[model samples]
Target: MTARETPESIVVVLGTRPEIIKFAPVIRECLARDVPFTLVHTGQHYSRELDRVFFEQLDLPAPDVHLDVGSDSHGRQTAAMLEGIEDVLVDVEPDVVLVQGDTNSTLAGALAAAKLNVDVGHVEAGLRSFDREMPEETNRVVVDHVAEYLFTPTEETRLYLEREGVAGQVVVTGNTVVDAVYQYADVAAEKSTVLDDLELSPGEFCLLTAHRAENVDHPDRFRSLLAGVAQFADLTGHEVVYPIHPRAQSRLDEFGVDVPDEIRVIDPLDFLDFLRLESTAALAFTDSGGVQEECCILGTPCVTLRYTTERPETVYVGANCLAGLDPADVVAAGSLMLGKQPDWTIPFGDGRAAERILDALTEVETDTDTAAATVTPTETTATETLQ
Candidate 1:
């Protein structure tokens, strides 16, 4: 293999807290390698409380451009972001624009970049739930087709792209969330006092995070999930700890859903605090895709509340199970995962995913024109080459 020049400049676009979390490693990689990059936050899922503290906690540089296109209907939200992102791409004219996961922000960023002739490098690319009811599923498909560089997390995902015949160069770079988890697990443990504060012990609590529209937007579904989770905790004899998103909490209140006394509801936690809980918890029930990846990586058994998941690798490895909204099934799935040994093979890659991704961009590809090489993390400046 030979070395090609690193792209002259890169633009990163993200919106939600998960995006912020998952993209931190890539942003840090840019910093480490002295890559000239710019950060553009669409603010699609912005909250002052979350945005300020999250960046501080991750120790990431602030967004160079904040397109403060906050919450709205899906059409309005994505359209505004698409418009704003196009403007930014026009101004910056970056060589490539980086987007992560399946969100409106991801779709907007990819579309904007593709329209402007800027190459799009999509992280966590080629995921599919096969259920088009999900806005995320649509976003994933569109972004994958539009992207020039598709960085997948697994061989399975790479194969999916192959089957779809996407024109993008696909590389199985592993999930960036795994990289984030490995990077922050020890740091969270050392710095967070969540267990002490919650009066919880290792393997004694069951965490719950239900914020997805499919689960929480409908009153009956929301109520059913709450009851089902309560029953699951009761069956397991584990305390149910719910760190509710403020938006979901309001929806619950609006729906007039009764909370079971067994489930303890609390305000949201920062990344470190939540990581502390998730790492120690006996089990977790969530509608969050990111939580599924994180719990699986942390060796904490998880039951996904959603009907379908883009990260099915977690389920394939026995680290997670899908228990979509039946009280009986929810309890059964939780019970099944509770006593199992955490012997599941880690499917994500070595912790050096960021290094390999950078290497692929800067180093020449193998004869297959697919770059899935791993590299050791060494001091490398912008002009450094992979040899």
Candidate 2:
């Protein structure tokens, strides 16, 4: 096989805490196997409190390159990341670039690598909310189409790719969040004292998170969501523990929105502490895609704060219900979910997703080597005969 034809190195690019948590196992696998790779951080989630704490808690190595392209309007942020990532890719000359989920960082990484003629592997690809209004939906669609390898998390996602006629090789590797949850949940339980600190008990409180622009940026929507959560807490007599994101907090102040006293808004938590809270919560109210998957995996009933969800498997399996922004709908959904038994089967995976993903990547390398070797000898023989 020609050395040039086979992948020799991989560049893993990510930006947020969720990306770090999901990719931690992949980075560890590369280190353990002595795989030649470089980690690149886009700094989309640039806050030290939000981003740096994840790396520390997850035990990930410092990124080889940091773009430091902090918050901006979506177009500007993505454009900045695209420029920065292309520079890094040119310098690294990696054989393949890997990105996870549907963030601006993920789309930028895929777009840069494709433009540079490098193979791009997209983890958590083929998800579709079909709502173009959501920036994440747009990012996932664009990245999936450009990626050379689509590592889907489920059969449904694989089918989504097939129906879309994606040119990439699609593989069902299960969700890496399953791996993260299984790996870190116990650690969180052992290390986190958030329950005691908050004066809450497990299975008695609701965990709430709303950071998406659609949910928190609009003053009316934000107020309605908070009011609904407050109502739910009052009705259930359960505390709603909300770990506020920096942007969300700023928007609240900028818009003159007030948090209901019933909803306890705390500072954002470390990954471990968040995981502990997620696993033990009686119910979860969220707009984040990752939280939906986490709730399903942890058997925690969830009321999705969005009108549409990409993870429909959660709803089909009776784990999540869509409540949108209507306060009455949110409370009703929460009430219904609260009474439901936690007996739904988890559709994500058995938590060996990281191992499977690494194996799939290695297999691609091997297959490329075999195909290159076969083609080289035949071409060489034909040239000799002609000569």
Candidate 3:
């Protein structure tokens, strides 16, 4: 390693748009403090929609390394990410390897770093859906167990951690999802031409995104969800902006679900543009967990198509709803939320999540004994109900 390669600390890993948005604030904190860091892109969602432009729009440094572990089945994708992340950890030896949320990349990276004693920090930790069938719930649970530092976005997540008997350093930093929105929304609002180009205006359209594995893994469910949204948009005479994921797009072609001429299926927007549109939209319909949170933060009510969510606070608070695969339910939920005034005090955190997480890491590294005392071995409950 050269002198430039030998940074004292590195905030190590992220993949997917959610990870990018959440961790960008952490990276900003590191840079502001002159703390050394290196970013590792695991390439779980290799499409430009999930990668590339998000980095550019967020003003994040180009990743020092990219694994390019593209799309595949859950098992194969994760195994590939494990090998790829392990290789990078061996090469980089970052003092801290931080991962965000519950993607396969997050679980694989956290496990790899923990096994190597690399002091892994799990951002957006302690989230649970109590559903084992959902791979993401499993990933989040496992990542939490392996993480040396658990940065929760809400008091609810913190309580979930304590209930699981995880006594590791728990800090209630606000959700970085909110942080990303605050940081990027203004810039995206000003710069994006998506609204004008699509002839969309706020309150006259509904934003749609559906790319979750459970929803996309089955052709019938995928068809129903898309058809439901398209049909509802037509019946209501509301413009629908559907930014289909590459995976979902492939499935659409495979299943012969032609993109409705009336439905605007376009390339994915960067974070800023997406946020800007989401902010001004009448409502959002999607299977994306981050989109659900972003919509809540932006005060645009959402109808989450999935049956369950790790972020249930949104549902409980009525900022979102679990409309499942049924088109009727989705239509009703969309209409209901569209007409209702959105309650914006989301149960998630204030925008100070990254700062609190960094402060905790600083304390943990400096006071080894106190950090060690905080660690007590204990059994953990499983999150297998969401699927």
Question: Of the candidates shown, which would achieve the greatest TM-score relative to the real structure?
Answer: 1
Q: Which sections of candidate 3 miss by over 4 Å?
A: 1-7, 48-50, 364-387
lDDT of 2 by residue, 140-220 (tens): 999999988787777788789989999988767778887787778778988999889988899999999999999898999
Winner of 1 and 2 under TM-score? 1
Q: Evaluate candidate 2 by giving its C-alpha RMSD to the native, one decimal.
A: 10.3
Models 1 onward score TM values of 0.93, 0.92, 0.89
lDDT of 3 at 33: 74
In order, what lDDT does every prediction score? 0.84, 0.85, 0.78
As a whole number from 0 to 100, the lDDT of residue 183 in candidate 3 is: 75
When 1 and 3 are scored with lDDT, the better candidate is 1
Q: What lDDT does candidate 3 reach at residue 120?
A: 78
- Clash number for each model: 0, 0, 7
Query: Relative to the unseen true structure, what is the C-alpha lDDT of residue 129 in candidate 2, on a scale of 0 to 100?
Result: 95
Candidate 1 to native Cα RMSD, angstroms:
5.3
Clashing pairs in 2: none
lDDT digits (tens) for residues 1-387 of candidate 3: 001222377756887878888899999988887778888888887874447788888888888888888888888988888888888888877888899999988988888888888887888889887878888999999889878778777767878998998745776676887777767777887799888888887789998998877888788898788777877787788888888788888888887777666578888777777887888888789888888888877778889898888888788777888888887887777777875576345566556667666667664332323322232112210111000
